[model samples]
Target: MENFRPTKRSKLELAAPVSHKNEQFWILDGNTVLEVGGVLFKLHRSRLVDQSIFFSHLLDERNVQMDGVVVKSDENGIVYHLSNTTPKDLEALLQLDKNPMAYYLVPPPFPVLAAIIRAATALRFDTYRAFAVKHLENAWSSSVTDLTTERKSNAVEVVVLARTCGINSVLKRAFYEMVRVAGYGLGDGEFDADNGERPQEISRADERRLERMREHLISAWLQVAVRVDRTFICPNQPKEPTAGTESRSSTLPKCPSLYSKRDAWERRVHDSGLYAEYKFDPFCGLQALIDIKWDEDEGWCSDCVHAKREVWRTMRQRTWERIEVWMGLDK
Candidate 1:
C-alpha cells in the first residue's frame, strides 16, 4: 500500500486545549499556553498584569523587544483581551503601526474635551475656556465646508456657548462662521441657555463635543465669577499678555475711536471718566447685537434697565449656588 497522510487532525491529536475556565489563561500560537491564576507567565513576548485593575500591565521599557511580536493587556478597560486588540490600547501599540511623532501630532478625540473641561472647572482655571474655544474653533473649521448634519449641530452649540461665556472674539467669529457655512436656520427657537433643545438635528459626535465645551465654559465661568471679579481678565491689567517679553509697553496703541467723526465727543468721554467705566455700552445686549435676526421681544430688550438688573440678580444667585457647591458648603 502507498503511504497515506491525513489532512484533517482531531483536536486531541493536534494539541492540548488551553483551559481558561477557573484560572486566568492565555494561549499563544494555538499551541503555547500560559496560565496566571496564581502562577505568572514569563515569556519574551508577555507581561504580567498590575495590582490595580484600572490599568493593564505596563510594557517594560528595557525588556521590550521590537523584533519579535509581543502583546500585553492594558488594564485601563481602554483595551480588551482576545487577539488582545482594542481601541484603548491603540496608544501603546501605536509604535507597531506608525511613527511616534505622527501619533503625537494628531489631535485627541472629542471625548478628551469632556475630561479636560471637567478638570479645568474643578481647578477653576480660565485656561480651560481657551482650550474649549480652540476645540470648537477647530471643529467649526473642519465641519464648515463639509456641511453634514453632525457639523451643523456642533456649530450651533459652539456659537451659543462661545457667545454666552465670552471666551474670545476670535473664537466667537469661528463659531459664527461654522453656522453660516452649515446653512443652519435658527427658526422660531431661541438660543437661551436654559431653554434651548439638545439640538436634535446634530450628530451624536458633535453633540458630545458641544456638551464638553458647554461644561467647561459654564463651570469655569461660575467658579471664577464667584471667587474673583471675572469681569476683569486679571486683577491688574487683563489686556497685558501674561507670558511674553513685551507685556507692558507704555506706547500700546489705543482702539480707533468709534466717534472719530467727532473727536470732541471722544475727548468728552475721556475727560468725564466714562471711558474708564467698568461696564461697556457697546457690549450691552451683545447677544442681540451680534445676531441680526434676533428678536429683542424675546425679553432681552436693550432699553429695559429693570430687566437687566433682574437678569444680573438671577445670575448672581446662580453664581452663589455654584460657589457653595464648589466649596463643599452645600454638602
Candidate 2:
C-alpha cells in the first residue's frame, strides 16, 4: 500500500484460547506445558522441537496433580500458560530458549487476584481503583502491606507493567512490598549491612542525608528518560551498582549504603506531591521545557515539556491517593 502509516500504540488484539482436550503429547517450557494433539515433542538443547514420532511419555497418573493455571492469549493467537514456578527453575529453562511465548501456566489465585489481572489487562483505572478500595476499605484494622501480600496472583511482568503505567495501585503496592521483602529499601530507611552488622534504627541526620542523595538519583533518572527512551529504565536491571563498576571506583556508593535515606526522601517527596506534579507537567510549550533545565537542582523542574505528562498527570493524582491509603498516610 502506498503512503501506509502505522499506529503508535500497540493495536494487538488478544488471541483465541487454545483447547487442551484434543491435545495428547506435550512439552514443558519452564512452567508452561505446550500440548500438541497426539504428538510428542522433545526438548532440543532446551527448546521444544516437535518430534514426528510420538512417545508415550507421561507423568505418573498418580503423580499428576490437579491445580489451577492462568492462560492468556497473545496477539498472534497463541495461548500462554503462566505459573509461579521457582525463579531457579525459570532460570534453568530460560537458558535453553528465548521465546517469551513458552511460559503460560499459572498458580491458582484468590478472587481479588483475578480481578487485578483483568483490570490490568484492560488498562482500566476505575476497575483498579474499585478493587483496591474493596480490599482496603478498613485500612486501619490491618497492615496495608499484608493485605497486598495476600493477593499474590499475577505474573511479575503484569505487576511491573501495571506499576509503570501508574494504574492498579494495589498491584504497585504488592510490587513495592516484594522490592522491600527482597531487602532493597529506599536510601532513607534502615538498611541491611553487608558487613554482618545487625540492623538498627537509623539516626535522623543520616536519614536527611539519604533524602538528598535519592533526589539526585531520581533527578538523574528523569534526565536519562528525557535523553533516552522510557524503556531505558527497565525494572529488571540491578537497583545497585554492579560488581565491576563498584571495584573500578568508589566514586558512587551502592544503594545498600543509603536505603533508609532513600525511603525517607521518597516519603517526603510523596507527601509534598512533587512527583505527581512533575509527572504531569501542566505546561507543554517549548519555553516551559527549557525552564525546567534552567532550574537544574530541582527534580523535574523542566518536566513541562514532557509529551506524556497530560496522561501521566491524571493517572498520578488517582495513583497517589490509592498509595496514600495503602501506606496508611493519615497516621
Candidate 3:
C-alpha cells in the first residue's frame, strides 16, 4: 500500500445544524447568538465581554479573525459556536446579568447554583463568581440541623466548588460541613457519589491538607476526652479524729462513690452519638456538654456539675483555637 486518499464526508454529516431557543435573559433581540451543546442562545456580546475577561479577549475582533471562528450572520446578528458547555450552564451565567436583586430575592435550586458557579468560574466572570459564592454561603450558613436532606447532600459539592473557584470565604465552612456530614473518610464516598472522585477538581494537595486537618481534629478530640476524664472533683475528707479523743466521737455521713460517678459521667460525655452531634455543631463545641444536666434521680452533686462545666469551657477555648488552623483558614 502506497499513498492512500480518504473519502470526504458531507457537510451535514460533518456538522449538524444547531437549534435556537429563546431562553431566560437571552432572546432574539440580543446582538450575538451563541450555540452551546446544540442549543443556540441570543445574548448581547457587550454584556458578556464586560462581565468576563475571558470573553473580552476571546471575542476580540483580532482573535476572532485570526482564529477563524465558525460564525453565521443573519438579520438578527452574528452567531458563534461555543463548545464544551451545556445550555443550562450558559443560561445560569447569563442570568447574572439580569436584575441583581432577583438573584438574592429568588434563590435558585442547588443544581442551578452549581451550574452558575461552574460557568462563572470557567468563563472568568469575577463578579458573577462572587455572586454565586455569596449565595452558596448564605444557603448553607443557617443551622446545619435545619438543612434539608438535599442540602446536606450537597456539602461536598460546595467544598469542591469553593476550592476550584478560589472562594476562600466559603471554603472553611464548606470543608467543615463536608467532614460533619461525610466523616474523616470523605474519599470513601460516604456522603456523595462524586465526592473525592475528581482529583483534578479537588487536587491532591487539597486532599493532603484535609488529611492533616483530620489528624489535628483527632488530637483535639482526645484532648477534650482527657479533660472530661479529669474533671471529677475529689470528695473532701473529714478531718482525721484527733490523736485519740475517741475512735469515732462523731460518726460521719457516708459519701457517694466517686469512681462510679466519674465513670457514668464519662460515658455520657464521650458517647459516640454526642461526638457526632459535636461534629455538625462546630460553634457549640463543648458547650453542648455543659448544657447537659444530670438527672435528679442519679444523685449527681452540683459541685461535680460545676467542675464539668469549667472543664468544658477550657476545652472549648482550646478547640476553637485549633479549628482555624486545622481548616487552613488562619490566614
Candidate 4:
C-alpha cells in the first residue's frame, strides 16, 4: 500500500522498504531478503545460492544484477531486488524446495511449471529449469507414436513453451503436432477429436505459418496417396502353384486391372475419411498408409503391396523432413 524504496542497484529497483513483506515467504531467521513487484520475501541465502549459479554470485558487491535482484537492506540483512520477476513467479521458484517431489512425481500444470522455468532461467537456476523441462520432454517425445497418445491440446502449449525455454529439440515436433488444432485433421484416436476442445492460443505469426503449412501439408500427403504405383507380380506369392487352390489362383484371383489397386485404395480412403484425418498429420497418416497390407484389399499381391508400402514409407520420411521448413521453424 506504500511505495518501492530504492537503494543503489538500478534506477528501476522496485523494492518496497516499508509496510510490506510477502506474508507467504517472509522468514523470521532468514539471512537474505528478495523484493519483487513491491513485495519482500525473507528467505535463507543458502537455499538460493546452493541451487543457483546466479544466486551464488549474487550475494556480493558485484552481482550479475541480471534483471531484478536489486534494492536495499535493513534488519533483514542484504536485500536483493527481484523486480523483474512477479511475486507469484518468485514464490513458485522458492517453493521448489518445499515441494521438490511435486516436480518429479506429479509435475505442476503448464502455467505453474512455466512460471518455475521462466523464473529459474532468469535467475540461472539450472536444476529447477531441468525439472520442468523433463516433464515437457516426456509429453513431446521424439517418437511420434508415443506423442500420438498425448492430447493434441498440449501441442500448441508446448510450441510456446519450447520457444520460451529455448528447448529447440522439441520445437519442430510441437509445431507439427499443432497443425491438428487448426482443423487440419478430421480426427485422431486419443485426442479430443470432435473439434470441440479449444486449442491453446498462440502468437499471430504462428497462426499465419500454420495456415500456410496446412495447405502444403495436405499437398504432401496427397503426393503419396495419388501415386498408387503399379506392379503385376505379387512377390510373397509363389510363382508356381504348389499343391491345391492355395496357389496363386486363389490368392491373385486375377492380376488386378491397370488401376484396380489404385481404385480400391481410393475407395478405402473415401470410406475412411482418411484424407480429412491425415491432412494435418502427414507423418502419422503416411505411416498408417505404409503399415497396411494392401494386397488384402483387391488381390494386389504381396510384391505390389510391399512395393507401394515402401513408397508410402519414403513419403512419410520426406514429409517429416519438410515439416520444419513448412512450419517456418527453420528460420
lDDT top scorer? 4
Clashes of each: 3, 24, 0, 4
User: Which candidate has the top score in TM-score?
Assistant: 4
What does the lDDT come to for candidate 1? Answer: 0.34
Q: Report how far off residue 143 is in candidate 3 (Å).
A: 11
Q: What TM-score against the true fold does each predicted structure earn?
A: 0.21, 0.19, 0.67, 0.73
What would the per-residue lDDT of candidate 2 be over residues 42-158, giving only the tens digit for each residue?
233222222111111112224333233233344323332333232222332322223323322332233333334333333223433343344332221223323322323223333
lDDT (C-alpha, whole model) for all candidates: 0.34, 0.33, 0.63, 0.69
Model 4's number of clashes is 4
**Model 4: clashing residue pairs?**
69-81, 69-82, 70-81, 235-303
What stretches of model 1 exceed 4 Å from their correct place? 1-8, 12-92, 96-98, 108-300, 303-331
lDDT of 4 by residue, 1-331 (tens): 9899956675444452443798878988887878777688888888878888887887755755555445576766667766557777778988886678866778787667778877887778898888877877776665555545244555666766677668877776666676755553323334553445554456678778778877887788777665464543545445765666456556543556657766777776656677667766677777777666667766676666677677777766666777678776677
Ranking by TM-score: 4, 3, 1, 2
Question: What is the alpha-carbon lDDT for the whole of candidate 4?
Answer: 0.69
Better of 1 and 2 by TM-score: 1
Candidate 3 regions with alpha-carbon error over 4 angstroms: 1-26, 49-77, 83-85, 140-151, 181-201, 226-228, 231-257, 270-285, 295-307, 327-331
- Measured on C-alpha atoms, candidate 3 has an lDDT of 0.63
